[model samples]
Target: MKLKLLILLLISGYSFSQVKKPDSLQLFFDSAKFSITDAHKTQLQSFFKDIKLDEVLQIRIKGYTDFIGNHVYNNKLSKKRAKATYIFVTNNYQFKAIAQQGLGELDEEIAEATIEGGNSKHRKVDLILSYEKPKEVSVSLTRKQRYLLQLPKLSIGEKLRIQHTNFHISTPNITNASKEDLEGIIKILKAYPKLKVLIEGHVCCGDKEEYESKIINPDNLALSTERAKNIYNTLIKKGIKANRLSYKGYGFTRPLDFPENTIAIQRENRRIELKVLRK
Candidate 1:
């Protein structure tokens, strides 16, 4: 317990110096248009790309709409605007958002305009970011921390994942322990519902051509592909939203810490790599 508290203090010490990237950003739609503009798309891409490595403590995206339309229409429009931005962010950054809400015409006293392209400012979505902070001196150390604590802020093109402890060379199954480990990731996704991830499956034994020839029963290509798909399905079966996850098979194409000579290294190769696509 003392060691755990010491580690928490150390992490909190580092977190105290960290700041949220962007702090706040926003997306605007054309009048009566709920879709994000292409210009805005480039802006968002550039903005998030710059902060790819920053630790994202919390993501909040709030959407708003002008009062030009009826209360019902405006409220729905605001949600659409927010959803578009949420999808865009998740598809690109793969960061799960803490909150995604539509404040439909809330706090707006604008005179309703019937003309086209009226009240552009209100048709917008705000992307707010929050950073980690140190626990108060008075606060007690606890094992239960935010879900983000267990996750690494995935880089744009970099591959990352929690290793499955129960993987077998003869099986294409995700073991019980592996499923439990994956449940931690589900919590992270729940915290950031709008986030999207690309799951890549890689296998060991030999290169692509070699696996095609050597591996019997289901082909080597199928082995990796099935693993990736199973992870994707497991998340779905466990009630994770389907739209947020994608999987691909790269059978022995991408290797880490090369010279995969040992059994441990080969096991490392037969693993899943989660890449951020939208956050």
Candidate 2:
């Protein structure tokens, strides 16, 4: 029965991958003013009203100036503008990370033709938002795989063991056979976009002190945590939304068997489990 289930998962993982374009927004500044004006603040607020900061993987801010002043002055002005925008956003919203840069004056060719007033278009800060791409498409699934996709049916706090997912001995590296099981999980996540899960990592052994000398990291909990994190990162790379997923390591604290004297029992204890966080 386990072999059949493993085969089904392996086949289910063969889906598709995709790419998505980054989102962009712009804030125009006055000729020499770097401070964000009231109108600009309003625009920024409106632009970010619908965006979820947690879902944003990266935020890039590029500040530019018109070709009116000396290179040094223009460069400083651009940096100030970028800094002002960065401060406003960081103070208002909570995101993973942000990158800011000052490009100084725009090239003559690229800079908007100086009109009667000034190069208003060229004096601006550009904002780009990046998110993880969704990497699944419509695909046939085995009966068991279909069952796995029914995450909505499960109640919160319920745990589902990834049967075939296993890690190397005392290491975070997952075996080749376990990669299929992870892909199968990814497919299920893609199928039910609303479903959220907490990945829990477990290991087999005696007390922490007993395994401290045997393990490379010297920390049993860290090893288990790394194992869980490995799966978490794989899910992210496979296009799973980071906001919908989280992971933690339990070490050998939550073992299925007490005396793991046999290799089979130990293998059973060293496993990955997913707890339903949202359905």
Candidate 3:
């Protein structure tokens, strides 16, 4: 009866503590055990869910054991313990973690040994919440930023077209004017690292053949494909993983409006579209 009350108190206390800013916390384990109790694990997972950890940031996890085994064996056991928690987090949460470590056994002289139920106190893991500090630049989201934050909720088939009139002209060159827009995109990708997108390039239909013919390439696809590739290159240069992004071109093949429409509409048709492949 007393044990049940203690667990109830623990769960309630942790629930209250979550209202504050995230600080480092420890999750204790049983002797020779890597798995946390269902109650404790549920509490830990709830804490992570309550927080808004970006998909890009890597989580730090460390495991330690009691001074009951040899150093070599304890190290290996401690690592397994850490890995168990690591797998649990990755499988359940959106965040990616890298700093998984096993500190072997805790020194008995330095810390209190968990004497109640085998050395349970020292046999435990710690989760240190950490984040990558964004570059100190004053960046405010405009009304247009709704596209980035709310995009994941939209239909998967919807293609998000990016407009950079000053950057991607009828040609493939990307200029300084396009950098600001591209920077915003990079920030979005970083915030949601798990997202994958396909960059599609489309060109205005011209009187002769097609706008894709503007650039001659033996492969028969130019202008449009190059434009898409240019945006892909730009994102890669900005440190976004290449696997998360891809580029393709469809010269005047997919038109939103009539091909022979007003210059404004024509320009709209010729655009770089981000087809969100996965969230």
Candidate 4:
């Protein structure tokens, strides 16, 4: 029972504090000179000292004149008075009083109240309450265009299309790919499920193979086939339907580089490519 009563008291006190309105205070104008008298100074000192956090407080420092000068001129003077008040509060009170704003002569207390001249009490600077500084929070997230490819664990029915060429093939290179590259690839794949991709694998021309010289070494073709198979297995493990994914090897037949029979050409030929067929 005692614990329940304590919790209730805490809740009630918090509610009351949150709903409390800011205190409003009025200060007489210091005339056109915009100088607060000694009496006003004492009151202001007391007000500043009493200011507390989580509470709103407002002060309207105004300027007034007898109907001696032009109405327009009086309005301008009132604005100056408000500005001066703001400066005083910010400089003297630091951030103790959040800040102050000048409403100028627009918010006249008396629409047509006149002192010496037919002037209104519109020239003033009204102080307002400010909210507390919001707390900062940290978050982790992937940026736009971030790519990740979970390899050795590709999803079933997942199809990845490369450039439109014989090199197009889904090889399980993701196993060795960095997180960034993997994510990028996965992101694209997920975006288009209906799209069908053909993965092709290739091999370098001068690779060492036992029957190369005699049997017209299909080293490139064999290497390319292996790469394609690796990718196919990965995708199958990922739960992608086997029918959705297809693999093919250009076997150095299709060269991304020169079409000649040079070692450099073979290197370029030894690459896997993906192409969208159904999409």
Candidate 5:
């Protein structure tokens, strides 16, 4: 019992000793549009001087926007702001800062188009310095595992998904779909009730010669549409709202697993993809 207590005390002490103070910085924008200024640069230099930038540290810079524009646009603007700050740090300070990121418009201290107590704090950049290395913080996932579980983000409005937008919709023969795959899709819809999905279907051709022309073949549309319509009907029969669902068949135009030009590749091309339009 005494040995166990001693070990616990030593572990706790080591953990406590690793903790270091992080530096905080705030940059404000007063113009209609945001821009990085000389004052911001000077403040950053002063802050870094107090802390040791020579020591290994990770710099996290986040940009925030007001609620004025669309969320997607605001998110992009925030990234730009963050990148600008990172460039300034690297150029002026001549230090290799790792992992610069933008948080976009997610965090806002002030309301857009509204001033409280004669203060508006929406357009700004937040800089943080951490002594922790990134390797200790990143989580790893294998390629096969990540691909099997990919899904688009469902937003209440348009452009809902943030990742994998290129894979909007796809369809393959439902007859060939495994029971497990069907159940997995049904599970996704049931778990997220507000989700509106658009299903697309595709068909595989044995020969790469099929796609020789700029124009698409009519059979491609027929096969793709058939699979998509079937899936849409199934979901409706299962009690999902008809208004919340739509389907389109691209035939062989959109392949999920394989590139065209061979038989095996064509088989992969024939698949189904579900896109979330609303949540």
Candidate 6:
């Protein structure tokens, strides 16, 4: 009876170990439309909701268009689709590494058949996520301390937003309220001697022209960059090594909230974030 019980337990363990989670997803779009629909957005949220950032190894996205358009048009459309998906994923989730490519039109035979059948599969983006299962470990630490420990494990391109790290209006000056957050970051850097990061600054509420045309109003860009530099300088002042840090400003280009219609949303957009470069 003991031998039979042991065999049953071993078999169950092997079966559990062999269980596989899905590694790929396909998101469809309306004809010639690059934007993700509400339905697809909900699907995406459900798909990614359970994924842990630390376990992700890489994400690759590929966009494809139907054969109804000319090569040039289809190629550009595919790129737009890819960009839209990429932006949505990056804004919503944190991951180690991600890459996107526009594969343009589907194969001619497949496109023709799909079109004849009124299928929309060709107008789609494929997202392939690869990750490793993290090992189970028991540790007793405060939430902030655990976050500090995880900082060193992040791969390049992964970002950690410094919550409440906001600045004075239209200036690079750090707000008094944000000092504690900065100190927390400094503590993490001091704890992990080999960790390196790039400070990124962003702002909110700008017109399309202001966002795109640097020549028309370069100050926004400069301001953002300076904000990041302010954080870099503060870290240096706090005794973090200068060689382990770099900074850049993105202005109003990467807002967390689009249109910037509300004060609260705009406040969320106007903040500083850090990208892990080395661990």
**Whole-model lDDT per candidate:** 0.65, 0.75, 0.68, 0.47, 0.57, 0.76
lDDT of candidate 3 at residue 279, scale 0 to 100? 73
Q: Which ten residues in a row have the lowest lDDT in candidate 6?
A: 133-142
Model 5 off-target regions past 4 Å? 1-22, 107-119, 134-140, 144-279
lDDT tens string, model 2, 95-171?
89888877666644334343234577879898888786444446456544554554554445446778878777889
- Model 1, 1-279: lDDT tens per residue? 999999999999889767545677767787778777789899887777767535776787777776564444565777788888888777767553466766566332222332244467667787877666523222121233232333335423324555553466656787666765576667767766766888777777665443333333246567778888888998899889889898877566444424567988787767886766665
Who wins the TM-score comparison?
6
In candidate 4, residue 167 scores what lDDT? 30
Q: Give me candidate 2's TM-score against the actual structure.
A: 0.46
Q: Residue 143 of candidate 2: its Cα lDDT?
A: 49
TM-scores of all predicted structures: 0.45, 0.46, 0.44, 0.33, 0.42, 0.52
Give model 5's TM-score versus the native structure: 0.42
Cα lDDT for residue 108, candidate 2: 44
- Residue-level lDDT tens digits of model 6 in 12-40: 99999787766878898889999978887
TM-score of 6: 0.52
- How many backbone clashes are present in model 2? 0
Q: After superposition, how far is residue 51 of candidate 3 from its true place, in Å?
A: 31
Residue 181, candidate 1: alpha-carbon lDDT: 57
Best by lDDT: 6
The whole-model C-alpha lDDT of candidate 4 against the native structure comes to 0.47
